[model samples]
Structures are given as C-alpha cells and as structure tokens.
Target: MYKYDQYDQALVDARVDEFRDQVARRLAGEITEDQFKPLRLMNGLYLQLHAYMLRVAIPYGTLSSPQLRMLAHISRKYDRDYAHFTTRQNIQYNWIKLEQAPDLMADLASVEMHAIQTSGNCIRNISSDQFAGAAADEVADPRPYAELLRQWSSFHPEFSFLPRKFKIAVTASDTDRAAIQLHDIGLQLVRKDGQLGFRVLVGGGMGRTPMIGHWVREFIPVSQYLTYCEAILRVYNRYGRRDNIYKARIKILVHELGAEEFTRQVEAEFAAMSDLGLDAPQAEVDRIAAQFADPEYDAGAPDTLDRSDPDFAVWVDQNVHAHKHAGYAIATISLKPPRGIPGDASSAQMDLIADLAERYSFGELRVTHSQNLVLAHVRKADLYALWQALAEADLATPNLDLVTDIIACPGLDYCTLANARSIPVAQKIAARFESDLARQRDIGELKIKVSGCINACGHHHAGHIGILGVDRKGEESYQLSLGGSGAEDASLAKILGPGFNKAGVVDAVEKIIERYRSVRSGPDERFLDTYRRLGDAPFKEAVYG
Candidate 1:
C-alpha cells in the first residue's frame, strides 16, 4: 500500500479545514442549499432521500489495516452500524449528520483518506483490478500507474469541472477485472516487444447510453500515457456538450464526432503537449512503483490444501483464486450473504476483516470492483483458519461469481433518483437462487447487476443478466437485458423485451435461467456464452410464454 507523503498529508488536511468551514456555513444559514450544493458535492457529501450520504475514496481499492479499522470506527461512531461497498470499489455511509461531517472528515484524514473527487465533475477515484498484485496472469501490477493517474487528476486546475463526471480504470491482465472498457478512459498495461505501455481506450461509459470504449491508440509508451491522457481530456473539454446534461458525457461527444475525428483531435493535442513535460519524471515513477513491490514470502511455505472437510473444500474451490506466489492464494470475502444486502458490512465485520487482513495478508486488503473484499496474499496453509473465522460471521458464502453474488445498487430504498426499489428485488432474486448451491454453481458465472434507475451506478449494462427499475404509469416496473459483459470482450447488454413487475421480473429471471440450462451445450458453458450463442430469442420466448 502507498503511504501519504508530506505533500499528500498537507493537501488532505487543508481540504478538511476548507470543508469544515463550508459545512459550518451551511448549518449556520450563511449559505442556502443551492449555494452549498456544489460545495458539499466537492467534498463527497450527498443529500439523500432520508439523510446525507458520504462516500470515502479508497484509491485503486487499496487499504491498510489501520484504514480498515478507521472505516469500522466511522460506521460505529458517526453513521449507521454498517456501510455499503459500492461497485466503484469505495464504501458509503447512508445516514450522516451534517453537523458531524467535518469531524468524520478529520477522522478520515488521520488515515490518509478523504472523500475528495468522489462525487463531482472531476475525475473520480482511480480504480484498478482488485487482484492486481496477486493475479497470476497479469503482465505487471497496475496500481503504480493507477496511483500516478490519481495524483495527476486530483484537483487538477484544468479539469476541476468537466461537462460531466468522468471515471478511469487500469488493468494489467488479459482478463478485464476492473471493467476498464466501460470507463471514460481505460488503460490496459501491456508488454509490447519487452517494453511496457498501455492499450488505451477512450470515451466509454454507461448510463442512459451505454458504450464500450473505442481503441484510441494501439500502444502508448508508459512514459507518455500522462501526456496522451491530458490530450484526450482536452479534446473532450473543448467540444463536449454543455447545454444538456444528458448529452454532456465524453461518450456522447465521441459518438457524435465519430472515432476518427476524435482520434485526429487527440493526436493533435498530444503532439502539441509533447514539449510541455506533462508526464511524470522517471524518478517519481520509480518512487511510486517501489511502494508496490512484492511482499517477502516464506521460501519453504507449503503449497497444498487438506480437503478433510467437504464444506471447507467447497468454499476454497469457489472463493480462493491462484495467486502469483506459489504458496499463497487470493481469497474473496463475499458481502452477499443468503438473501442479505449485497454489499453491506457491519462495523463488527469490518473490524474482524481488518484483524484478519493483518494476521493473514501482511496488513493489506483490496476491495473488489464487484463489491467484495480480497485478502490478496493469504498463505495456502492458513486457508482453513481464515475460512472458519469468516464462516462463523456469515462472511464465507462460497459464491464468488455465481448467481447468489449479485451486484446491485441501492435503488429507491436510498437513492432519491430511483423510480423503483432495487434492494428488495436484489434480495428476492438472490434468495430465489441462493438455496441451491448446486444450481448456482451449475448456472456458472452469471453476473446479475441491477440499477434503481438508468444512472448505472450499479453497472447494470455490464452484467450477464441486467435489470433496470423504471416507473411505469406510477407503478414500479423492471426491465431486463441480457448478454452484457464488462470484460476484455466488452459489450453493452441489449433489452430482451417488455418490462415486468417486481414479482414478474424475479420469475422471469428464473424462467430465463431454466431456458439457458435447456439450451446450453454443457454445464461448463456459461450463461454469457449461451446467450451469445443463441441470442435473445430463446430467453425472450421463455419469459413471455
């Protein structure tokens, strides 16, 4: 994990002081709601339906034990007893008091964390693969580059306010675990001819209009990525729509201007900025990379697991992944319990996780983009003990990418913009399939993502099976889409057909699963593969008939 330097500490401390005054002004009636809206938003505070919501940034989803403990303390002392892990790999507190927000910000600053740029027009928290350092297949760890981008974009004078909010994701493997293709700017770190660079994709996003990014450049030398990224942002800022919020996204601009023209303009900008020295110097790059170097491993650590307990074995098979280190494995702590909220973790659970991370994985934890937690380098020999602790707390669900592990946003239950409730729907769907582990495993890697509305905070457009809530004639209705993925082979999901009521949608999902089972080539064939093979006709027929 990267520790804050003197400069980082000063920046965060100054921001906390600044926001403290802003909050005091709002509470004292010196500023009206309209006047305080942008000010509070800049500090990652939102006035929700019932109360204020605060989203704290976990840059590149990395957290130290003290940081995790701080989050647990925040939940216990300030907001509710639990917090929700979001699809952005950040954590949110639903119930917050405006009076106590400054105190909370001060607590976060103690741990080198803050809510800055978490919810605004500026680039949000930079995200990357949760399994970045541990994943066996990645060419290199992507966190160093992600951190560089975070430092570059934070409170940037030129990009403080864009036409709309922008997001960026970085990954270093063929598998796109970070969903980079669905971001405003996606960087895939690749090794070309023994030299490191990035395969850059630009103008990708999801909302009312979902799109996979266009490949802006085949490969950008690692040294020039900062310059190239500046060029892209400049192009978007220059021509992106300002009149309509709906049409303000860079994706919309890219669509209207066409990829070729966007590329031409970006190229011109990049060429112009070449001599300005926008890219970070080699010394700074090494300083960042050194912090991410691999942890010391026991050379003689055993590499085998005992399968004496079938239940423990099942959990291992489902939740544990191969690590880059031979003696260790990456373990995903599933937040989606049977019929429980998808990403809610209580203060007690957070504290226990922090302790476990320290004891098992060198005091480090990684938050998954899918709303789970990862102990990146757990020793294989200690797997059973970790499993036992997690199982006791109802944390070991053994459904990593299965149907029960659904990714859903807090819909009408919390979000004021929602037309329908998402939590109940997600619960019902998970409960419907959660009882049958065999069925869930049989269904294979089915990502069911739900959003309360089209804002796509839940990333519904990227799921293998997607559900979107809408208000139909003053009633809550659900629309279903299929065949979407936020992977290396990224594609936007297409709507299957007409919408359904809450009950009807759950039933419709079951029917679609049954139909997929009947049509798929074998048990090994994933729902996504089956959908791509047979298209929407069979699934639609299954639901309507």
Candidate 2:
C-alpha cells in the first residue's frame, strides 16, 4: 500500500478545511443550492432524493487495515450503519448530513483518504486491476502509475472543468479486469524487446452513446507516458462538446473525428509537447514505484489447500485465484450474499474484513470493480482458516463470476436520477439462482449487471446479461441486453426488444440462460462465449417468444 507523506497529508488536510468552511456557509444560508452545487460536487458530495450522498475515493481500490477500520467507524457514526461500494472502486454514504459531511471529510483525511475527484467534471479516480501485484499473467503492477496520475491530476488547472466527467483506468494483465475499454482513457502496460511501454486507447465510454475506444498509439515509450496522456486530454478538453451534456464525452469527439484523424491530432500535439518536458521525471516515477514494493513472504509456506471439506473446496474453487508467487493466492470476498444488497457492507463486516486482511494479506486489500473485496496475497496454506473466518462473518459465498454475483447500482431506491429500482431486480435474480450450486456451476461464468438509469453507473453496458431500468409512464420496466462484455474482448450489449415488467424481466433472464445452456457446445463455455458463437437471434427469440 502507498503511505501518505508530509506533502500528501498537507494537501488532504487543507482540502478538508476548505470543504468544512464551504459546508458551514451553505448550512447558514449564505449560499443557495445552485451556488453550492459545483462546490459540493468537486468534493464528491451529491444531493440525492432523500439526503446528501458522499462518495469516498478508494484509489485503485487499495486499502490498508487502518483505513478500512476508519471507514467502518464512519459508517457506524455518521452513516446508516453501512456503506455502498460502487463499481468505480469507490464507496458511497447515502444518508449523509450537510453539517456532518465536513467532520466525515476530516476523519477521512486523518486516514489519508478523501472524496476529491470522485465526482464533478474533473478527472475521476484512476483505477487499476484489483489483482495488480499478485496476478500471474500481468506484465507489472499498474498501481504505481495510477498513483502517479492521481498526484498529477489532483486539481490540475488545465483540466479543472472539462465537458463532463472523465475516467481513466490502467491494466497490465492480459485479462482486462479494470474495464479499461469503457473509460475515457485506457492504458495497457506492454513489453517490447524487453523494454516496457504502453498501448494507449482513448475515447471509450458507456452512456447514452456507448463506444469502444480507438487505439491512438500502438506503443508509447515509458518515458513519454505522462506526456502522451496530456496530449490526449488536451485534445479532448479543447474539442469535446461543451454545449450538450449528453455529447460531452470524449467518445463522441472521437466518433465525429475518425480514429485516424484523432490519432493524427494527438501525434501532432505530442510532437510539440515532447520537447516541452511534460514527461514525468524518472526519479519521481521511481519514488512512487518504491512505495509499492512487494511484501516479504516466508519461503517455507505450503502452496496447497486441504480440500477434505467439500464446502471449503467449493469456496476455494470459486473465490480463490492463482497468484504470481508460489505459496500465495488472491482470495475474493463476496459482497453479494443471497438476496442481499449488491455491495452494501455493514460496519461490522468492514471491521471483520479489515481484521482478516491484517491477519492474512499483509494488512492490505483491494476492492474489485464488480463490488467485491480481495485479499490479494493470502497464503494458500491458510485457505481453510480464512474460509472459516469469512463464513462466520457471512462473507464466504461461493459465487464468484456466477449469475448470483451481480453488479447493481443504488437505482431509484437511493438515487434521484434513477427511474426504476435496480437493487430489487438484482436481488430477485440472485435468489432465482441461489439454490442448486451444481446447476450454477453447470451454468458457468455469467455476468449480470443492473443499472437504474441511462448513466450506466452499474456498468450495464458491459455485462453478458445487462439489465437497464426505465420508466414507462408511472411504472418501472426493464430492458434486457445480450452479448455485452468488459474484458479484453470489450463490446457493448445490444437491446433485445420491448421492455418487460419487473417479474417478466427475471423470467426473460432465465429463458436467456436456458437458451444458452441448450445451445452451448460444452458445459465449460461461458454465456459471453456462447452468445458470441450463436449470435443474439436465439436468445432474442427465447426471450420474446
């Protein structure tokens, strides 16, 4: 984990003081709602339907035990006993009060965390692969770069007020767990001739107009990484639509100007700035990289888990992942329990997870984009003990990447922008497949994402089975989409036909899964793979008929 230094601590403390003053002014009737809108948004506070919502940034989803404990304390004291972990690798407090928000921010700053850049039209949190350092198939850990970007983009004057919110993600693994293709800018670390570099993709986003990013640079030298990113951001900041909020995303800019022309413009900008010294200094990069050095491990630890208990075996097979190190594994702690809210972790659960991370994972953990938590460096020999502890805390659910492991937003239940309730749909779907573990295993990997509105906060655009909630007159209806993915083979899901009522939506999903099962060439084939092979016709007919 990256520890905050004197400079980092100073910056956060100053921001907390500034926000505290602003909040006081607002509550004293010194500022109107319209006047305070941007001010609050800049600090990651939103006025939701019922109350103020505060989103806290979890940079690249990494957290220390102390930070996690502090979050638990905040939930217990200021919030409603729980916090919602979002798909952007952030956490949200839905029932925040304006007066208490400043205190919350101050508490967060005490633990080296803040809500800056989690909202607003400025660059949002820079995300990375959850299994960054521990993954077996990664070129290198991407967090150091993400941290560097975080430092650089914080309150950058040039990008302070862009057309809309911008998101950037970095991934080093062949498997794209960060959903890089769905971000404003996506960087993939690569090695060519034993020299490290980046493959840059720009303008990929999901909103009203979903788009897969176009590759601007096939390979950019590591030395020019920051410079290249600046060039892309400059172009978007200058030319991206400012009149229409809907068309303000960089993806629209890339769409209007062809990829080739966009690349040409970016190249021209890079060429001019290459000599102006925009590249991050090697010393700075090395300084940040040193903060993320691998943790010490015992060489004598065993590599295998005891599978004598079938329950342990099931949990192991589903929740554990192979690590780069010999005696370690990446353990995913499921937040999606049976009929439970998708990413809501109680205060007690947070404390327990923090304890587990300290005991087994070097006092560090990572939050997944799918709203799960990861003990990224757990020793394989401790699997049984860890499983027992997690089960006792209701955190051991053997449904990683299964249909029951759903991704859902707060929807109409908490969000003012939402037209329908997404949580209930997600709960119903999970309950529908809750029983029959064997049947779920047979179904294999199926990603079901639900969004409350067209904003795509739940990442419904990238799920194998994407559900979007829409308002029809006064009632809520759901639209189903198929064949979407957010992996290395990124693609937008296509809508199936007319919308369905709440119950009909679940039935339609079941029918789609049954249709997939009947047509799959093998049991190991996933829903996305089957859909890719058979197209959407079969699934569409199965749902509509």
Candidate 3:
C-alpha cells in the first residue's frame, strides 16, 4: 500500500515519455525490429507468439484497488478480456498491440503503476512476502525495505546491464512464503537484542541450474544494509560471467568463486564502499517506511464475526490467514477452481477483486507468488460476508497450499519458447485431485509446479512434485521431479528418469503419490517429509520401473 511520491511519479512519467517516443519510432519504421528489441524489453514490452505482451510491475506484489481497477480496465478496453498473473506476482496482457503499448504505460502511470524493470536482465520486480505486513509471526514488515531496494535499484546506472537478470526478495516471517531461498539475493528481516537487521542469503536461483541460496551474512544492521547490498552487486557486476547467458546469474558466479572467496570479495568491496558512506540515506528509508504505517484501528469492543454460514466457515478455515493487526485477517482469493485456469482472472473477476479490495480489505490487494490473488487486511468480523461475495464471483475456492492449487506458466499456448501447454496440464491435475478435503488433508503438504520448458518460469524445480514439459520427437512430453520444496526447507527437485508422454504424466504423478502413501510412517507425514525420509529411490522406482 505504498503510495507514489513526487519523485516516484516523475520517474514513471519520464519512462512513459521515453517509451512513447521509442514506440512511435518503431511504428514509423524509423527503427528496425533488431534495433528496437532492447528498448522495448527495457520498458517491459514483449513480442510474443501472436501479439505483444506487456508486463506491469506490481512492486512487491502489492496493489491498491484503484490500481487493480485500472488493470481491469486496460485488459477489457485495450486487449483481451483477461490477464495472467505470473509466478513473480506481476501481471501480463498477452494481446496488446505494439502501437498501444505506450498508451497503456501512460494509463498505468495514471494509477501509479508501470512496467519498468518487469522485463530485461536488470533487477526485476523486488518481491517480498505477499503476507508481509499482515502475517502474525512477522518480526517486521519487509515491504519498507523491499520498497527501499526497489527505489535504489530502479535505474542504478551500473546495474542496468548486469551479466544476467538479478532477483532480490525479502521476507520477515518465519515461514518463507516469498521463496527467498530461490532468489539471487534473499534477505530475511531479523531483530536481535534491540537492533533490527537482515540475515542475507546469496547465490540462489532457478533456471537450467537451480540452487538454494547460501547464508552470507548472519546479521547486517539496517544502517549498513544497502551498503552491503551494493558490495554484493558490485562484485557480481565485475566478475559474473557474460560470455554465456546461462552462466551469467549471480548464482553461477557464487558457485564458480567459492562462497568463502565470494564473501571475502564482497567484504573487501563493502569496506571500500563504507569509507565513501554510500548506504541508502536514512531519510529515504524513513520516508518510505512512513508511507506503510499500520492503519488505525478502533480498539473497540469485539465485533461479531459470524461463521454460521457453512460455506463461509469452510472458506475461513481454508482461505483466511492470521494478521499482525488485531481483529484483522488476510484473505486469499483462490484462483484454482475445479476446472479453472490456475491464475487467469477474467476482466469481470478482476473488477470484482478490485471492488472487494476497496470495500472489504483496506483498499489494498496483493498478488501472491503462488499465482493467487489476496485481499490483505480484511476485518475478521466481515470474513463471512466477504467469503459470500468472493464465492459468487468464483474466487472463493478454498484450496490454499494444496495439491490442486498448482503453479503453472503460459506454455506452448502463448509462449513462443514453450514445448507444450502448461495451463491444460495444470487444469487436468486440479481436476484429477478435485479436493476431497479429507483426502487432500490426508495427503498433506504437496506443492506441484509445472513449467513449459527448462526455463523454469513456473519454478518447477521448487515443487514437491515438479513437472517439466519438453518436446520429444515432435510430441509433447513431461519430465517429473520429486522432493522439491519452496519453503524454509527449500531444495531443488530430483528428476524421475525418462520423460513421459502427456497422458502418462498424470498417471506418473499418481504413482509417485501412491508410493509416498505406501511408505509414509503415518497419515501425519506429508509427501515432502516422507520423500526426504525415504529419498527418491522409492518414487523413482515406482515411476520408472
């Protein structure tokens, strides 16, 4: 819920003007496609399979109702009647016309949102826990720091052209909901004694080479946070591989230079940088933090939060989460229905979400990295009523962190690089496991991620059951992976031998789950825990042999 200041407003407006001119030139044939590619990418515009796709940044996955409504209007008016929420918590319009992109950017600026840094090999959108401010167990809200980094990295001249894309995520909660370990730089907000700081993790990434970040700094005081971050980036910028894009990420840099050596280099850079005293200005930090102050609450007598409605109770049990503020909760609007596309929200649905955010929640909505929409900071008392409204809009599917609530990327259907379709595969899986609540609760803690290619856009490597789609001899095939997780205990999934044809992938998943069920010590053991205990041998044997 951070509002844009004059500086932020000026920056976006300038970018819009810049892109407007670039787009006009491209349309006028003043620039060739080759000459225009980087310019378009820097502005977050993509030439996709059928049309241009414009990705808009929802910084740290947070949005205001006005912002959400603006997006809905954009989708309905300019392009298709729906938008796809990406795994990074950004939203994409797939059918945008090349000429209209600049207009769209201007429209986004009207609502204080823009597509800058949503694409390109620069620091992408700075994501934090979608539940940051609201999560009950958080030590501090991570958004302030995330926003601070966002402003710092926005157009940092030196980092604009890094060897590869850089991603940074911060989380304040005990549970790693932001998938911090899977990011190039993960900062865990921590408090020790009376001082607040960050526990920094470096080198984590997921693409062809997936890695869980290594802890580099145990505690970096808030005052020194940005200084240290600069050192890390400086080190990567100087030495990170550029000859090969695949080896260009900071993760690969950290791997090639041992963590100890990498840490030493960063420390040396930090020591030198500190002498110049270029840490983020405290005034800037305080200024951003002020924008995110906790909303004033009544502190009055408890209001009645009725759950008498059976449907409402079901939703509360499944979709609601504890909030840091008293008498408030975070409500996740599930995108996974019995047969619905996992993260596709139609224009009408987007409008409904925007309205709900304005009315029930605090005029703030958050898109989760898990591809679900969240109306954070809803008053507990209005939970039932909100559920009723969401249910009517087909947004009240109560399957959070469950098997049916799968994560998928736009595959062969929309993405030019994809080998197979991801949405349909996700749909088929959801239908196959169509939520017998008891059965799913019994199965427990399964994270299935499916991606169209080895690019790992859907983060298949982080799934408890990862499926990677590939084209084999002119046919679509899927490769299954086991034991992956994206939580505090993050691990790269292990592949289960030969890839299976489209029809065989589902059966293969069933076989893996059955093997887990058979080997599990008790019903209490989740698939991940059991998989860890027994290793991939059992699941591999079941699927491959």
Clash count for each candidate, listed in order shown: 0, 0, 0
Error of 1 at 512 (Å): 0.6
Tens digits of per-residue lDDT for model 3 on 227-272? Answer: 8999999999999999998899999999989899999999999988
- For each of the candidates, the C-alpha root-mean-square deviation to the true structure, in angstroms, is 0.8, 0.8, 1.4
lDDT by residue for model 1 (372-459), tens: 9999999999999999999999999999999988998999999989999988999999988888998888888999999999998888
| lDDT per residue (tens digit) for residues 31-54 in model 2 | 998999999999999999999999
List the lowest-lDDT window of 10 residues for candidate 3: 296-305
Against the reference, the lDDT scores of all candidates come to: 0.94, 0.93, 0.88
Q: Which candidate would rank higher by lDDT, 1 or 3?
A: 1
| TM-score between candidate 2 and the true structure | 0.99
Off by over 4 Å in 3: 301-305
- Over 4 Å off in model 2, which ranges? none
- Show where candidate 1 strays beyond 4 Å: none
